[model samples]
Target chain A: MEDLDKELVRRARLGDKDAFAAIYEHNLPRIYRFIYFKTANRATAEEITQEVFLAALRAIPRYHDEGFLVSSWLYEIARNKVIDFYRSKKSDISIDEELEERPELTSTDFVKTMETKIEADKLKNLLKKLPEDYQNIILLRFVEDLSNEEVAHSLGKSLGAVRVLQHRALKALRKLVE
Target chain B: MTKERIHNLFDKAKEIKPSEGFLSRTRARLYEEPLDHPRSQFFFESLHFGATQAGIYATAACAAAFIIYMSSSISVNEKQSVAMKRTEQIEDYKIDVTLKDARYYKEVAPNVFVVVSK
Candidate 1:
């Protein structure tokens, strides 16, 4: 998969519109799904997802391997766009001396995101019964389909720390499930 | 959660497919729009001759502006000093002229033009 992605990336980088179209067709859903998970609003998610691909198109010539996956890079762009959207929304709330910090995704936000995930749908109210950090770990681990290493990398936690968190998260989830 | 339960959810979740025509539309959009070259790369690391030339021009313009600013500052200082010197010379000339007039009057014989108009 990585090889195929790289091939498309190379062609896209070289201005091959057809090859890039194939890549766009292949990855748009996954990308859209990722963005949808983050934003939790269909309209906002769709906008940012399209922006990510457009940004990737513009940045293709300058894209460099920064020890990050192309998808990760795309996600980073989406993340920034999401942040901007939230910021714009916040400004509309009322004028103030300083902009409010992005409302850190509360348990409510998590539930909104996981409302569709497997047993999670039936377990929404139950999931909230778990601790925030545990919920964070479970979401990143399963719904996000991130590897343990990738989770650690994304979270800036050591492998041992992530492992410990995962253990605790699963135990807590089990209690909720029971 | 039981494996059976987990598998049940997974299977059901996976069935909630993404929108149809998404890929086709995206492909058409991708082909419809040509890729753009990022402009910020020139700021970070650009090798284009045009970009390099723009950098060189910017550097040269900044350097030239600095030189002009410094030269103008120096010229202002020099003009101020020159003006001060001229003022002092005028004062000195006035003093000299006073002294010369006194000497010329003193050198005149006391008897000369001695019409005592007491």
Candidate 2:
């Protein structure tokens, strides 16, 4: 998978639209999922996800491989975009408030089945209550199943730090669940 | 909830994804805009390379100028020292000749005085 990503990135760097499309297709679901969990709104998630890809498209020409996965880089961009989204809003609208306001819109096609939608929403709400780093650690480490090294690179933290954070995040999630 | 239960919940959340419509729409929009031109990338790369080359050439030229300036100054100093030494030698030779003439005149004068007296 890394080799494929490297090839696609090389082609994309050379202005290959198809290669970039392949990369976008491969990473879109995870990126969108990450953003969706963060914002808890479908429209915002979709918009931010598109913005992340657009930013990636613009920046790929200057991208040099630094021994990390392309997905890690995309996650970093997605994380920043989410932060920027909140910063731009500058409103006191908490995640709970936003979720309540857009209750009906939270269900994406991926969660169309009633049982899965409820489960996903419950998990997302619990995730939103955690501190930002803990939320990111949990989402990227468990939900996305990224490797520890990948999570560390994506979050700009050390491997040991990621491990410690992961433990703390899980403990906090357990408290929320209880 | 137990750790296992939480893990199970995360596994379910993994199924969450963006809608197909959103994915296709985003893809279409992205591709419609176009990727950066390869020519532009090459141009910028060439510009960077040109800058580096120019810097290297400028440094080499400066070094060459300094070396030439230093070597020429050293040679000029050597030439001046040699000229000064030659002048000193010439002056010493003149002084030696004058002393020898004075000695000869003194000796000849004494001899002439003796003849006159006799």
Candidate 3:
């Protein structure tokens, strides 16, 4: 994996379009899957995924060979992008608080919408029950499929620390699920 | 019934693949962005890479300058203290004027008072 990344990076440094394409192909699944879990909806995930790739394209050049595992580097970048998205989104909600103006619903298709809304609310509440750090860890580990080592590298933590956090995070989620 | 449901939820979440057209749309966006060659490639890299190097250099230079500055000040202090001690020693001498005045008076008034040399 490291070798392939190095190869792509080398080609990419030389401004090889196909190499960049190869990187995109290799990474899109991981990026998309990670984002999908953060946002439980499909459309938002897709938009964030697009933004991730665009960001990657813009950032590929300054990547140094400071023993950075490329996948971890990419994962870190994606993590930051996701955080930025959520921050912007949260701030936007605070701006107008426009959603509060809606009256009691009388529209058709309301039952299905209400069901999804309830489930979403329940899921969000369960997510909130975990510490923010644990939530981030679980999202990266189980949902993003990044290895503990990768997560540690991305988060700039010791392997033991990441492992401990992952353990605690899984336990916390188990409480929520059960 | 168990925590497996959440674990399974995560698993199911992973299995929920993106739509098939995802890549094509991605490719379109990719192409729309300059592939591996854009003005920003230079702007971002030069700005970031240059700034990192500059920061490290600046920190090291400042440290060196501080050391040099401190050592020079210490030596100056040492020299100043030595000069201060010398000034103190020179200033400690208090000359008495009585003996010299008396000698002059005797020499001028020899007719009135004889001064014997002892």
Each prediction's total of clashing residue pairs, residues at least 3 apart in sequence or on different chains, is 0, 0, 0
> Roughly what TM-score does model 3 have, to 2 decimal places?
0.58
lDDT of 1 at B63: 100
Write the candidate numbers in order of decreasing DockQ: 2, 3, 1
Model 1 clashing residue pairs (backbone):
none
In model 3, the runs with Cα more than 4 Å from the true position are A66-69, A90-125, B35-118
Tens digits of per-residue lDDT for model 2, A137-160: 999999999999999999999999
TM-score (chain B) for model 3?
0.43
lDDT of 3 by residue, A8-118 (tens): 886676566678788888877777766655664556667788887777777776667756557677677777777888788743222111123223334553454445444
lDDT tens readout by residue for model 3, B22-64: 7777887787776555566646755776799999999999999
Cα lDDT for residue B89, model 1?
A: 55
> What DockQ, on C-alphas, does every prediction get?
0.09, 0.30, 0.17
Q: For each candidate, C-alpha RMSD in Å?
A: 18.6, 13.2, 17.0
Q: Which stretches of candidate 1 lie over 4 Å from their true place?
A: A66-69, A90-140, A152-161, A168-178, B2-11, B38-118
Query: Candidate 3 — which pairs collide?
Result: none
Cα lDDT of model 1 by residue, B34-103, tens digit: 5463445433443464578898999999999999999999999999888667556544554333544545
Q: Which predicted model would earn the best TM-score?
A: 2
Q: Which of 2 and 3 is ahead in DockQ?
A: 2
Which 10 consecutive positions of candidate 2 chain A have the poorest summed lDDT?
Answer: A93-102
lDDT of 1 by residue, A1-178 (tens): 7777786776667566766667667666656755544443444555677777777787887777655446656655665676687777733222111112223446775454345443433543444577655654565576557677766665556779889998987777665555
